[model samples]
Target: NAGVTQTPKFRVLKTGQSMTLLCAQDMNHEYMYWYRQDPGMGLRLIHYSVGEGTTAKGEVPDGYNVSRLKKQNFLLGLESAAPSQTSVYFCASSYVIGAGRNTGELFFGEGSRLTVL
Candidate 1:
């Protein structure tokens, strides 16, 4: 089974265009996250969900929105794409260890690279 999967794999957009990225997991994880990676900045959280139907903004959520309509899927949307929003996005999921705690080992999907001009 695919532990985690990300769609489009790659995309290119012009400024102001909009698109959505899809992520799916089959491990029944209760926690899911969206992150973006830049050249030297590592990865930055864009949004996350603690459980199905619950979503919250992360560190770099400014240019993105996310939804967790079902336990096994997460969706990230860009309302209006911008050049600065271009980056390699990653989707991850893991089990919640204890209340507010995590094992720190996340299952990651193959990255989705998006570029905006």
Candidate 2:
């Protein structure tokens, strides 16, 4: 089974264009996260979901939105793409420990690279 899958591995968008990045996981993980990586700076969390139909803002959630409609799927959306938003997006999932804490390691997708002009 595919552990995690991200769609549109690569994408280019104009300044105001919008796009959605899809992430799917075969593993029944209760915690899923979206992160963006840029040069110099390390990965930054964008948005995350603790379970199906439950989502929360992460460290850097501005200009983006996330949804977890199904247990195995999480989607990230960019309403208006910007050059500042250009980065490699990674999707990860991990099992939740007791009290909803995540102690296990995360499984990450290959990553989706986005470039906005």
- Tell me the TM-score of each prediction against the true structure: 0.95, 0.95
Task: Residues 29-80, candidate 1: write the lDDT tens digits.
Answer: 9999999999999999999998999999899899898999999999999999
Off by over 4 Å in 1: 98-101
Task: Provide the RMSD of all predictions against the true structure, rounded to 1 decimal.
Answer: 1.1, 1.1
Provide the global lDDT of candidate 2 against the true structure. 0.95
- Which pairs of residues collide in model 1? none
- Which pairs of residues have clashing backbones in candidate 2? none
lDDT of 2 by residue, 46-66 (tens): 999989999999999999999
Single out the weakest 10-residue window by summed lDDT for candidate 2.
96-105
The deviation in Å at residue 39 for candidate 2 is: 1.1
